[model samples]
Target: MNRVKRLIKSVPGSTWAGILLMVFFAFAAKGYLSERNIMNILQSTSALVVLAAGMTMVILLGEIDMSVGGVLTIAATVTGMYLKLYETITVANIMIALLICCAIGVAFGLLNGLLIGYMRFNFWLVTFGTMSMGFGLAKGVTGGGVLSGFDTMFRWISTGRVFGIRTCIIWAAIICAIVIFVNYKTKFGLHIYAIGDSEICAQNSGVNVKKTRFFAYVLSGLMAGLAAVLLLARTNSAGATLGEGYEFNAIAAVVIGGTAMDGGKGGFKGTIFGAIFISAMKNGLQLVGLSNYWQQVLLGVVILAIILYDVINSKIRDKKSLRRVYSDGI
Candidate 1:
């Protein structure tokens, strides 16, 4: 009985919201309950799951990575260029391309980590600046053009099916699983929560605040890079703007999943649900004939509502805590 209660409590509010949204959409949108549509939702949200998983880590530390979109764009663009250069793409070429994408992302991530974590630079300033630089570099490299037309094997990375499941989905699940394990079962994960809850306290307890913060950003960048590969493979094209608006969406997913933006209070499990919810919402809106513009408008409203709810909920929890203390003292 206690275990059941704990399990239920461990589930994030987003999971319930996602279930309700799916129920609503299933009735409202024809064929929404179909396996095809369900698979499509998972496929579309795979990259986002990867991206949000990384965002969860950063947010847990009370920091944000605005440069994720930029990192994805630059990584995808460079990797796309490499793929286009090849007439006959071998497995080796694919491996090299993956390396290129990850390297670019990690390099930028290292810069953000170094500046913000070690040098005591403001995280916002560092991440935003890197975002601009990443986008700029991608634009300059491509000369404001796009790269498209890749080998079949390269495309297969995302589009290929394994046991009737998209490879992208499989990759996302694997990555999310690893992240969840690291976040819950590892020392570093504990440190992330500690720092987010109270940096001074964590520092006094011998947590290497700088190292944790630095690695968090690096992981964020690495995930963006991996997401870039998935996105590139799916779209079969890459450009400077390929990753535009992704940062916001990823952040939205993380926040909507019940991870507090102030940090130290969320995990990747909620983020997976949140990503699926967003994808389902968009898919349902389209099925119901809503325009892209209206979808964007509704999305913004939903994000605001969720954030407001979180704030109110936080206040309520604080009040309850205070009441508990008073009662105990009495």
Candidate 2:
């Protein structure tokens, strides 16, 4: 009984809520549990899941990266330009294009990290500035147009199924697993949590606070780039507006997954559920005939409610700690 109780306590409440929502939807909505619907949800959510995983690390370090959407667009734009330049499709060409996209992502990510982490600039301001710059560059790349006409192989990767599963879903799962391992099993991950808890304290304890923070942004950028690759494959096209507004969704997934906005208090497991929850909610709402505007409103309400609950839960935990201390003293 004690072990079971401890196990229950170990799981975040948001994770539980997400599970309940899935169960409720499965019962309440016709076809919600169908294999086809499940696959659709997984395929559609793949990119968002990857983005959220990266954002989760950034949030865990108590920083925000507003440039995610722009970075994604930039990556996609660069990939499109590469393909356009080559005018051919080959495994080698594909590899080169992917490398270029990832490099662009890392470059922007590194810039944000250096300015914010080392130069001591404001995180939000720096990221916001970079966001604009990235978007502008993407627009300039194609003169505000779309890039299409990739070979069949490019489309196949995005649309093909391997062992009856979407490739993007597989990519998402792999990324999520890597992030989970990094967060829980690595020394750098430990430093991330420490810095999030208290930067000054972490610094005093010999944690490379600036470097850790910098790397966090880099990881975030890399994920965005990788996500961009998958998204391009799935859509088989790229435009300046690609990935617009995705930053909000990624952040929402992280927050709703029970990762504290204040930082140092979340895990990847909850985030996985959170991503699924968001995707499922959106799909379910559409199926139930909710308009896009109404769906946005409902999502906003849910996010607000979750944040409020987090605030209250934090207060309650603090109170309990105080009570325990007082009781021990007495």
Candidate 3:
């Protein structure tokens, strides 16, 4: 009984709820439950998981980045252009492009971080502004169009299967593991938790609130860079609008996975499951004959539900905490 209780506590309701959603969808569309279909879902899930890992860090610090889709579109478009022009994708170009993407994310993130962390501007406001700017840059970069055609090497990154799993899935797993390590085994991770738990408290405790938030934003950008590589390769195309709506999808996965949108709690593990669960839900929806329009609507509804659940749970927990404090004569 103790072991079971511990297990239940370890697995948040958000995580379990997401699991149930997957099961419900799979049961609704048995085809989605097949081995091959499961693999397909994972394949599609790999990139999002990467994105979520980044977003998780950002949100853990009580921030958001709406520019990810724009960042992703630019990364994908640039990578595709190189691969198409030269029949070869070089390690150097890959490194450079990723660096550029990361730098862009960090620069924008720092810009946002400065406004929010230093200047007392609202996080959502700064991020939303940057999001618009990022999208404009995306359109400007692509000359307001889409770019496609990928080399075999690039295509294999997304489509290639080895040992019955997609390469991007492998990459996602590796990155996720690294994120888990960073979250669980580092001072930076502690700082993330501290900042999230209570910024005022963390600051009083000598945590460099500005620096910690900056790190979180940098991590967010890094995740975007990694995700772009896998996403472009998998889809075999890029466009100014290729990654439209991805920012919200990532937020949905993170929030759905049990991470508090308000910050201080949650880690990459929940977000990974959240990412996979989301992938399964979308794939299953398609199998159930839902039109693309309805599928998007369903996603929105799910996001709303997750947000509502978070709000209620938070209120209940706060009440419980207050009651405990009163009971203890606080």
TM-scores across all candidates? 0.94, 0.91, 0.88
Whole-model lDDT per candidate: 0.90, 0.86, 0.78
Stretches of candidate 2 off by over 4 Å are 1-13, 327-330
Error of 3 at 214 (Å): 1.0
- After superposition, the stretches of candidate 3 with alpha carbons farther than 4 Å from their true spots are 1-13, 87-103, 113-120, 320-330
Question: Once model 1 is optimally superposed onto the true structure by TM-score, how far is the C-alpha of residue 188 displaced, in angstroms?
Answer: 1.1
lDDT of 2 by residue, 124-243 (tens): 999999999989999997899999877767666567788988888888888888999998999989899999999999999999998999999998899999888888899888988998
| Per-residue lDDT of candidate 1, residues 125-149 (tens digit) | 9999999998999999999998888
lDDT of 2 at 292: 94
Worst 10 residues of 1 by lDDT: 8-17
Per-prediction CA RMSD (Å): 2.6, 2.4, 3.0
Worst lDDT 10-window in candidate 3: 93-102
| Backbone collisions counted per model | 0, 0, 1
Work out candidate 3's RMSD over C-alphas: 3.0
Ten-residue region with minimum lDDT total, candidate 2:
9-18
